[model samples]
Target: MQTYEIWDSEYRFMTIVWDNAPIGSGALCTLCLQQLGWKKSTVYNAIRKMCEKGLIQNENATVRVLVPREQVQREESDAFLRRTFSGSLPGFLNAFLSGRTLSEKEAEELKKLIDAHRKEG
Candidate 1:
C-alpha cells in the first residue's frame, strides 16, 4: 500500500482533479483559478508535486488521479486516530462525540454496524 501524506492545500487541489478527471491541463488551471484563486503557475506546480507523489498523472495535457480519494482518506483517518488517540477507536469516538449528540437513527445504525463487525470468539 502506498501511503500519501497530503497537506490541506494539496488535498483541495486533488479534490478538484478527482471531481473532474481526464481534464485538460489548461482547463485545470482555469478551474483552479476560479475555485481556488490560484494562478496558472500555482496549478502547474501543484500538479507537478502531486505527480511526483504518485497521487496524480498528467499525460498528454490531461490530468487523472493515480490514487483514489478513498485510500487517502482512510490513511489520513488512521493516522489521525493513531496520533491523537493512541490507535484506540473508542478513545477517538469518545473525543469526537464529546458535547455532540447523535440522532437516534444514526446511533442505531452505528450500533448495527458495530454488531456486524463484532468478534465471534
Candidate 2:
C-alpha cells in the first residue's frame, strides 16, 4: 500500500473533504473558513498540494477524496510504531497503556482482536 505524508493542517483539511466529499470547491472553501479559520488562498493552496500528491481530486469545481481515511490512519499508526517502538507492537502497547486504564468492554474488544490476529505458529 502506498502512503502519503500529510501535515497536521493538511490532515485537518482532508478530514473535512472526507466527511463531505463531492462538495463544491466554493463550498469547501467556505467550510475551511468556518472550521479551520483559513483564508481562500490557503484552502486553494492546500488543495493544489494534495492534488499533486494524488491524495485528492478536483474536477468540474468539485472536490473529493482520492485516498480513504482508513489507509492514511493505518500508515500513520505503522509509522508511529516503527519510529517510536522499533516496530514492536508490545512495546508500543505497553507505553500507550502506561498510567491509562481501559474499560472492561474496551479490554474485551482488544483481547478479541488480538486473538483473531494471533499467529498460527
Candidate no. 1 TM-score: 0.59
* lDDT accuracy of residue 54 in candidate 2: 89
Model 1 segments more than 4 A misplaced: 73-121
Residue pair clashes in candidate 2: none
- Model 2 over residues 15-118: C-alpha lDDT tens digits? 99999998999999999999999999999999999899888999999998899987664235444335467778887788777834678899999998888889
Runs in model 2 deviating more than 4 A are: 73-121
| C-alpha-based local distance difference test score of model 1 | 0.85
All candidates: TM-score: 0.59, 0.59
Candidate 1 colliding pairs: none
Candidate 2 has an lDDT of 0.84
